[model samples]
Target: MIHFPEIQSEIQFLTKINEVELHILREDQIYPSISGNKFRKLKYNLEEFSKGNYDAILTFGGAYSNHISATAAAGKEFNTPTIGIIRGEELSEKIAENPTLSFAQKAGMKLKFISREQYRNKSNPEFLEKLKSEFGNIYILPEGGTNELAIKGCEEILNENTREFNYIACAVGTAGTISGIVKSSENQQIILGFPALKDSGFLSDEINRFTNRSNFKLIKDYHFGGYAKVNNELLEFINDFKRQFGVTLDAVYTGKMMFGIFQLIQNGFFPKGTKILAVHTGGIQGNEGMNRKLKHANKTTII
Candidate 1:
């Protein structure tokens, strides 16, 4: 088995609102490159890869995908070759301008840029066969790296220390992280998922596929537009949050979840004396790319 660094996530108290206590589980500090849920999601997958005869690990992701960055970093750290099927063909020439893709390239990941239409068929068997023919002996990981092994890895995020909380909250992307949390959560602890995408009603079904538990709820109001979309309000909140708590949240996921959690607190969504533990599933590296976009658009950037 491949050895992994010990997880050092800590539950830190944030503040109390309306007699409700809010705490943050700092999974973001797990590892620099492979941070937060990405680290958990990739832990067992990399172990499985270590035991396999595959020549390279091939995965799919967008230009600013934290998965792509983390996978590239993991491949480099483990001395294994990696291939990244990037979503936009236009990004081929713009790699120098994009921080995430540039980091991936520097980490020794061979990037293959494809059109948006082609990217949509990334899971298609025919398309996968074409990739296999091109890159021999590749072990394929899904777009967000949310396979069964990934879920199993995520299950380790929650422990006895987390049991005291009345509610567990996390930023949901592929639903794999929340599913694992729900599986390991105490019976009375309600797991709240804040999706980073708009119209994420389908995430319920995705979470259900992994666990039969109905104690989880997807709070759909926090997406703040959709995946990778951010507004000035969200950016200000992220900046203010960092200034106040010294915790940096990525605009795409954690920032929105934290924003929603604060809103929910003010709205009396949680009963009095409720203890909420919000999991900080990290993707802070993407903030640089997001800030670049904000700079170009003349909008507020995350601090």
Candidate 2:
């Protein structure tokens, strides 16, 4: 019920140096749930479904994936059946085991699983063939819920407020969203990406293949650890961020990139007083369990 429109430009940063301000995209501020770049990407993906009748929309996600949750919400919104191909096999587990997964199931999404290795080959012919044979005529969504069509929706995030900054920064995962942001971004604003995956070793190639261009750079060292992994420093920053800004930070993706941004600023990457914008792509649903544990840990420490 957190209306993001009201939170527009709500996340302001007064850096310790020169008191420079960095604005946060916090696109998820409006919905928190089913908000963020997911809503943007799905707005168009499901628009055609509005006209045509389909049995279901099939997408991929990890055990606790924001994309899966958003896809379920979109399916519910559009009155379409959704099937989530989760990456691991835990279908028989109790709902109490994983709330985010349960929420997706409650949204009426059927869950399927492939091995970790098979998941790596999810988009390959053998996998799609197996899915098509099993599910029959279902629409396929790429892992991380990113696709070329998703770009059209993702780019719209910057439309209303353009040319407001000299640079734009976002956390990149599958590169679809970042590539789209880079393409539609004002040429004047330098778009930079801090990846949440280790080394992002192949990230530049992934973006080029996704966007068919070679105009971007990837800052790979920001991952801290591999995707969905975190460490002590991130938790410290998340706590300090809450104390300072009153906004909770999730560990996996946004926190790492945010930590990277602050470090980059300290390292003097951006010119003094340069205007910069950072996108707070949301995935709070995945954090509910992690936060609970973290809070207990924090309390235990205080005790």
Best-performing candidate as measured by TM-score = 1
Per-prediction TM-score: 0.98, 0.88
User: What are the lDDT scores of the predictions, listed in order?
Assistant: 0.93, 0.73
After superposition, candidate 1 runs with Cα above 4 Å error: none
Question: Which 10 residues in a row give candidate 1 its minimum summed lDDT?
Answer: 1-10
Across residues 79-186, which tens digit of lDDT does each residue of candidate 1 receive?
989999999999999999999999999999999999999999989999999999999989999999999999998998999889899999999999999999998899
Give the per-residue lDDT digits (tens) of candidate 2, residues 67-115: 8989998776656899998887754364557777788888888988767
Q: How close is candidate 2 to the true structure, as a TM-score?
A: 0.88
Clashing pairs in 2: 3-30, 4-29, 4-30
Error of 1 at 15 (Å): 0.4
